[model samples]
Target: MKFKKRLWKKVSSIVLVAILAISVTGCGKSVSTSADASNVTVVKVGTGNGMPPFCSLDANGKAVGYDVDVLKEIDNRLADYQFDIQSLDFTTLLVSLDSGALDVVSHQLVKSDVRKTKYLFPDQYYCLSPLSLAVKTDSGIKTLADLKGKSINESPSSYEYSLLTSYNQKTLGNTLKINAVSDLSTADNFKQVANGQVDAALTYQSTYKSVQADLKIDNIKLTDTVLVEDTYIMLAKGQEKLTAAINQALKDMLSDGTLATIAKKNLSEDVFANYTSLIQTTN
Candidate 1:
């Protein structure tokens, strides 16, 4: 009996040692997994579905376009960063970012003195096509002078409107008849000009290009040589870390020609090359 009791004691001691070793190994693995999970970073980006060539949803319910590609390239370079795109209207993006509902605005947002006061914009990634005055092919208007005293339609509070008003005051020396619309979807503004309800339309170059074939606009001309160049991407004020990371990533992309390639694929032109000089000049 003494021998049996001694053997039982030895067996219990060995069992306890085995259990302790397993517990230590499990704890180590749990810690390693936790650290790995913590390495993943999530960035919330805002986009406008109304803007095409910059950002929009495709038929598969996936966000895909020039801005999407640019953001993806940034993510790919970061390797551990992930992105979640939130769709909103053009005007709401800045407010959403300010309200902390979004970390970044990835749509085609132009930087202005007013915006600089509220948000931090990184180096401009994409320079949008300049705004121009588009008229139907049948219209005899061919220059800025021709648009004098003409009725024009544009979205209210948009850069287009601001540009038009500036041109009217500075170039035309008079304010033309102005009609403000709410959104681009109605194209009511465009339709107004197309049906002769309005004499001309102030809009983006891309907007004119997309509808030119449909609208049969042949007399589209750039007036006053005043180009409105838009640079996109904005971060909330004080988001230094995110802004730095994005700027660095964009700089690398721009150097490696990734941005030029993506721009060519989406916009059908080497937008980066065409606009790089403009960006440098502005800076």
Candidate 2:
């Protein structure tokens, strides 16, 4: 009877150990399965409407542009991932990115030291036509120094405004009368300059080129001051993996001449060459 009792106790101990091992193995499998399900993530990209060459909506309401093409390239490279594009205003794009409403913003945002603090800017994929001062041809403002006391119109919270503000603070010793305009769609700001409501307006080179032929501007010269030459794809903070992936895809695009081909198609010039030089110099 004593031997039988001892054997029974040993058998019970072995059974308990087996049961505990099976429970642990089951828990591990559950955790692994949960992790796999969570890993299937979709990255939402934010784009803006009516921003040609960068982002626009087609008649079928599809997101299309140079930015779209770049994003598609990234998707192709990252076949394991998926994406969806959301359209909003340029101003709203940043807010969405900050609030996690969007995973990435591809509006060709210019990289600034201040913005770098809040967001992670990937490699630059496009060079914006340089910023230039636009004045009515009849207006006799010929040089940057000539517009000392004159009011200039610029988009609010834009790199143009920042650049001009910095210049005023550093060199001018006094703030120039700068009118903050929110939208460039209506040309209301340009009209202000033309109607002499504002002394001048700062605008992009491509925009100036488009309207220069029609406007009575005597001369719209591109200033030697290149304010924010290249634009980058921006990812929100703490997105190290996504940022690295985008940078790698961009490098590959550059290597295969995809970027240059797109730039030439849109701008009719080799914009990529200039962008490459700017990136090398800045880095």
Q: What's the true lDDT of residue 161 in model 2?
A: 72
Over 67-175, each residue of candidate 2 has an lDDT whose tens digit, in order, gives: 7877776776764456787878888988898899998988767777788888887774545455556776766766556687889877767766777787788875555
Clashes of each: 0, 2
For each candidate, give its TM-score against the true structure.
Answer: 0.75, 0.73
lDDT of 1 by residue, 92-146 (tens): 8767887898889976666656667778877745545555566666677766567
Clashing pairs in 2: 137-217, 137-218
| Candidate 2 residue spans exceeding 4 A from truth | 1-40, 58-60, 173-175, 184-186, 210-228, 274-283
**Highest-TM-score candidate:** 1
Regions more than 4 Å wrong, model 1: 1-35, 143-145, 211-228, 277-283
Clashing pairs in 1: none
